[model samples]
Target: MGVAGSGKTTVAALLAGRLGAEFAEGDEFHPPENVAKMSDGMPLEDSDRWPWLGHIRDWLAEQAAAGRSAVVPCSALKRSYRDLLREAGPVRFAHLTGSRELLTERIQGRAGHFMKPAMLDSQLATLEPLGDDEDGFTVDVFPRPPEIVDEIIAHLDR
Candidate 1:
């Protein structure tokens, strides 16, 4: 998981392919109201996120119940958010990180996404990173997407 333009979607998809796991995009789980909020370039508060995170957690649970491992790309920007998701099952996060300039450029280059370039700062402000106790590893976003995925896979193998 990572901020907007951190290549979370691209890297997650690659990871899914590598692991032969089911794939889910966190954005797809957002309620219309959440989409509307982000589409309006408004930063979502924690209140705007709980229900959405719950939906994501449910989806993860569904996949696990069906005996599947899945890769989901989400802006799990806070430690509490990740903790809530862990209640779903054994979850592993792969956080992608990069400089602000790179993130901003990537966001601006994209089109038709609900997340606005303007909201990147808010996301950065909200992000707590994958803490030491969190079951995850961080990969630099500067590498090629496949390379980043490979790094994540290497960690998983360990």
Candidate 2:
């Protein structure tokens, strides 16, 4: 999990492939209204995200129960959100982090996504960097997508 434009999707996809897990894009599960709100440059309130988070948790649990590991790309910007996800089971978050400048460039270069570049500020404002208590690995998104995936895998291996 990470902020927008941090290449979460790219890294998650590659990691899921390498791990033989089903890959799920968190954006795909967003409610239409949430997508519309983000598209209009509005940040989602906690109330707006609670149900969505629950949905993700349920999906993750289902996958785990099926004995299928899954890689999910989610922003999960808050500690509360991560706690909710953790309730699902032993899930590891691979956080992709980068400087605001780099993320801005990525957002600017992207096209046709529901999340507008303008919302980046709100996202950053809301984000609480992962704490020591969280179960995950943090990788800076600078080298390359493949390198990011490799880093995540290396971390998980430990």
Could you give the C-alpha RMSD of every candidate to the true structure, in order shown? Answer: 0.7, 0.8
Query: Lowest-lDDT window of 10 residues in candidate 2?
Result: 113-122
Best by lDDT: 1
* Model 2 C-alpha lDDT per residue in residues 1-158, reported as the tens digit of each score: 98899998888899999999988889888899999888888889998898888888989999999998988899999999999998889888887889999999999989998777888898899989888988887899988999888889899999
- Candidate 1 TM-score versus the reference: 0.98
- Candidate no. 2 TM-score: 0.97
TM values, all candidates: 0.98, 0.97
Best candidate, TM-score-wise?
1
**Model 2 CA deviation exceeding 4 Å by range:** none
In order, what lDDT does every prediction score?
0.93, 0.89
